[model samples]
Target: MELEYDTRYPSVDDLRERARRRIPRFAFEYLDGGCNEDVNLHRNTADIRDVELIPQYLAEHRGSDMRTKLFGHTYSAPFGIAPVGLQGLMWPKSPEILARAAFKHNVPFVLSTVSTASIETISEITEGQAWFQLYHPAEESVRDDIIRRAEAAGCPVLVILCDVPTFGYRPRDIRNGLAMPPKMSVQNILQICGKPNWAIHTLLHGQPNFETLRPYMPAGLNLKQLGAFMNKTFSGRLNEERIKPIRDMWPGKLVLKGVASEADADRAIRLGLDGIIVSNHGGRQLDAGQSAIKPLASIAESFGDQITVMMDSGLRSGPDIARTMACGAKFTFMGRAFMYGTAALGNRGGDHTIAILKLQLQQVMEQICCERTEDFPAFLVRSEITGSAGSTMSNR
Candidate 1:
């Protein structure tokens, strides 16, 4: 909430080379490709930058806060904004400019049910504190009218995803035809006429559809009949009889986003779920798996106290969210680092990528005198080059 960004793009690889020179190489390779041959997306950020953090130079210090909390709500930080599916084709209104920068930085901003804004316009731009993934609908009355429009848009949390189940052999989204009713080709309209400010802000924000499945589509279906109505209306696999009826019809916070295993974090804690993100989809669904920090360190060391074990694939910074919260991930999410900061600073890319990840995680919690954010697991670094046991390192 104290933003002034554009310090020459202070990293996320300089906002991914200024969002690959301001979009349109098939929308920056569909927000930077990942399936097959990406090899678990470059080993999910090279195994989370091979986790390392240790800095108690004469311990005893209390000077870093970064709030956090989760599930019961506190979040000034602990990473968020990991739901990306055609976010205004990468920039135009980029999901209401990252749901108004995740409601002016309180945090959390999930939103993608094939997003392009909707669900009462990002719950009135995060007034309802955005969070709602759910790509399930093979029709249970369109998944109970999208969980009654995310409980009448006061959505607290509801994720759901469960890895793409299929559709990730992404050869740059199949040579940029970008699947599902998306073959605009003529060399993709000459690479969108060479990105004239991303083709004039996608012609004043018009073509990015799927606005929460436009009340179950079918109005003027072109583009291969809207990709055959999104492959005959969704269903990407999730068991326990489709998650015990969305855990008995969603009451509130219930995550479960593509968990990588510990037997699906013991089946999202025997189908009752409250959390479990350990994603693989960021590797764009499989591509010979492994590297979501090796199934988030054995599913946060075997179900991190049974659930709430959050994570996302290859996080990009803030010390890779403090090495995935010192390797246990109580919370973390990052769909292409705030979409490479709104495709490189259009509408100040979500408060300049959440203020350069809260000033590089408060300078690594004040150079590891580590005062909070759960004491970053006492600055981990336990030896034999991080073979677990609370690992961290950086005193070179």
Candidate 2:
């Protein structure tokens, strides 16, 4: 379909800047900052940008088509909205807005387990087209119940997270009262007061809560209690033992997200996973980890035939999407970019961001004379960068 987006904000950087100005400082930092020094955070995008695609203008090309097939569904684009927790905190009703847009755009929207909207709500919004991501719950009963809820909601895919065995030490979140034993401070209140637009919408929507986990949480729990509850509830660690039961129970396409190594890719295949998302939790968990694209190149080359290889974490633009695909990522997803859009433009943010990404990708595909999304790898200009350990990443 022909796309029309806001000309004022043409890129994600523009949306991010606007989002920063529009939302409170703490919320923006939570969405924007990475763990520790953010070394991996900046490296994610930088390494991807270093990847060059060879344009073949002389080749015969009818047109470019971005339609991509994955897990028995053909999507309009190769990219989807990666799961983001507490989306409502970033922008009220942001998850639902993005879910509606994803459904309309014929792309997947993976709802985070901790997102503001419940599975049933998002499923209703998308007409059972949305996917659900599973965070590791402590009890088998809770895990099974949540999986059952996802199945009942008509979730086509169950993406289980593997990267966050423990919470990353984000100094920004700790200072902003987003960490364990969270306490709202006067400084945070003043920042919120400064952004009247954000404050008004937040007030209108009510405070963001873990809507999906509300059943398990006690009523009227304070901020500190809420943090304690979360800590006690989710173990945040996934091993072969934990995954076996979920794999047996879930009757949908099973995906393992936060894969950053070839051994883990092999493990996913051995465990009968339908796919693996080559990610580093968007550089949120480990500051010392390698950029997702670096491992993606090896993982895709090694296990692409055995299991689907998709990627997230560091893709910010259409060209970035093209770069990852050229590096062997079967499909791509973006988290902060979509959140930035919703926080910046309110309801129209979802549609506008999707439109701009689609248009941007179309331009790249046509310029490279690539007719289909699957043809992206043929246009890749392989370059190598050696790591500190002497291993090389072809993605560079």
Candidate 3:
């Protein structure tokens, strides 16, 4: 589909700035901030940007093609939308907006278990092409029922989250009273009032709810009850015991997200998972942990052939995606980037962000004389080699 985006907000940074102005501080911080001090958060993008690529200006070149194959499906682009919870809180119907846009762009959109939209709704939007990310409910019955719903809706992949054994200590969330059993304090109300556009849209669309889990939740529960329900309902730590049942039950591809170490990658292989997304939950779960790229490089080196090695944290632009690929990621995903888009531009956010990323990535491919997404490794600077076969010391 042809996408006409707002020319003014061309970059992800621009979208971020606009989103900050448009949404309330609580919503913006929830979408943007990482755990304590955000050191790992900043480090993720910083280190990924440090990767250098050498352009082959003299080489005979054809136009770039961004098409990529993953899990037996050829997507239009190498990157897809990472699942984000409470998406509608950021922008009304943000999950549905992204799911439809991803389908239109021929890229995958993962639906979070705690997202504002339900499984069946996103499946219908994407025509059963969207993937589902399971938060691993505390009860087996709840987990099985969710999986069954996804299966019935014809979801192609089931992504199980492995991080977040305990909630990250986000000071902003706490200060804003956004934590479980969220308190709508006066400060939050004043902040919401300042963003009239956001407030109006929220009023029009109705308040954002955890639509996927609404059936399981009680009606008109207070903020404290909501917090208690969330705490008691899901288990964040994923182990072999929890995963084995999901693997056996999920007929489609099973991917383990939040995998950071070679050990976890190897375990995923041992557990017979279809793929492992090398991520640290966008640097939100661990404040002092290594950047996603650091582990991605090692994991891709050791297990690239055995399992599909993908990554998600700290990627914001097309060049970032290219950088991750050069470091040895087979595929990449983004969460906050798309949210920033929708929050900044409302209905056009998804299409606009995807178009911009596609353009930027294609430009990188053409500039480097790389024909396909998989060939990005050949342009990586030798010093940054992650055990890939195509590391080159010379720029020539």
Candidate 4:
């Protein structure tokens, strides 16, 4: 049976559902859950929904342009694929699939430090369109070695994740017995068996080994022991002293992800970071944290001139991308949403996710009478958010 692309998974929710059905329970929960109570996860999406857009009418909105310039390159859309760890676990060869898709669509696909594939693999797959996100191991030598690998792989940008001071206490993971380097269990085996397609894909590919970690990992360890090794090896906390070597060594645009406060934004600027993602690790780290969009306007206002202030966390669609742009983010990235697409459709996931977001953004641009990407910030109304409604203001 031939599947129609348009009708199969129209929305992110639909893709998420399909992904849930196709992937194992433990893997799905790990991707979906946030820290502790998951208050911040709910808040991230809710807050984005709460802030409504005031559509402008009676303006010649012909030929809306979604093109955006960031880090000295023009992107088809303002959004890019965010770095998600253990992508192969979500779906077999997910990093390669996503990187190829992003390359075809002419957008960025970030590779996580803990991802199954290494920068070199992604570099080949993505044709250097893949950006590397470093978790910054506790040891300086380890960090330096990783940075050298990224540079050698032709990674144009280095994204240092700054907010993972410690691993979040996700109850979902605890309940599912899920963490990095997943262990095999009867329940997990049953779940895998239920999705024979996924199981076959994984088996044919030989268990989705972490090709990136082959150099460091010990021999003869199963997935469970690998998990323990990773948990013990990498330090969750990242600081300035740790960042100095990376900033000094990497010859590319440096970004500090997981910046949620003005203090952190200020620090990013001081450290000479090329950009900063005003994210709370997609609300995965702090359950009570505010939505990534909420602090963006203020942060952009304070430091947009000094540094690039991009954002991520709760962006669901193109309109959501527009809304975040209206708030303040120079560019946006989506992690779970794209992963949902990849997990939902396997080989076809990346293209479908990009297609959906591009169409959605085009619709928002047309409705809002926004002709260009830069013009969106100008139409954003700051006062309507405060109350009386219909009050429009220029960019703050």
Clashes of each: 6, 0, 2, 0
List per-prediction Cα lDDT, in the order shown.
0.82, 0.92, 0.92, 0.83
Candidate 3 lDDT, 336-360, residue by residue in tens: 9999999999889999999999989
- What are the per-residue Cα lDDT tens digits for candidate 4 across 1-396? 112355768889999999999899988988888888788988887776666666668655567988899988898889999999878888989989999988988889999987888789899987776899988676677778888898888888999987887788887777676756555678888888898988899888777666776787789897678778878778878888777878889899999999988999998888888999989898888877787877877888889899998989988888888878877788999999999998999899998989988988988888877887766676665543322222233322
lDDT of 3 at 306: 94
User: What pairs collide in candidate 3?
Assistant: 181-223, 181-227
- Local lDDT at 267 for model 4: 86
True-structure lDDT of candidate 2: 0.92
Using TM-score as the measure, name the better of candidate 2 and candidate 4: 2
RMSD of 4: 3.0
Q: Which ranking of candidates, highest TM-score first?
A: 3, 2, 4, 1
TM-score result, candidate 2: 0.97
Provide the global lDDT of candidate 4 against the true structure.
0.83
Question: How much is 160 displaced in model 2, in angstroms?
Answer: 0.3
lDDT by residue for model 1 (89-171), tens: 87888878888987898889898888888889889988898989988878899988898899899998888887876667788
In candidate 2, list every pair of residues with a backbone clash.
Answer: none
Ranking by lDDT: 2, 3, 4, 1
What's the TM-score of each model vs. the native?
0.35, 0.97, 0.97, 0.94
Candidate 1, residue 4: CA error in Å? Answer: 21
Model 3 — TM-score against the truth? 0.97
Cα distance off (Å), candidate 3, residue 271: 0.5
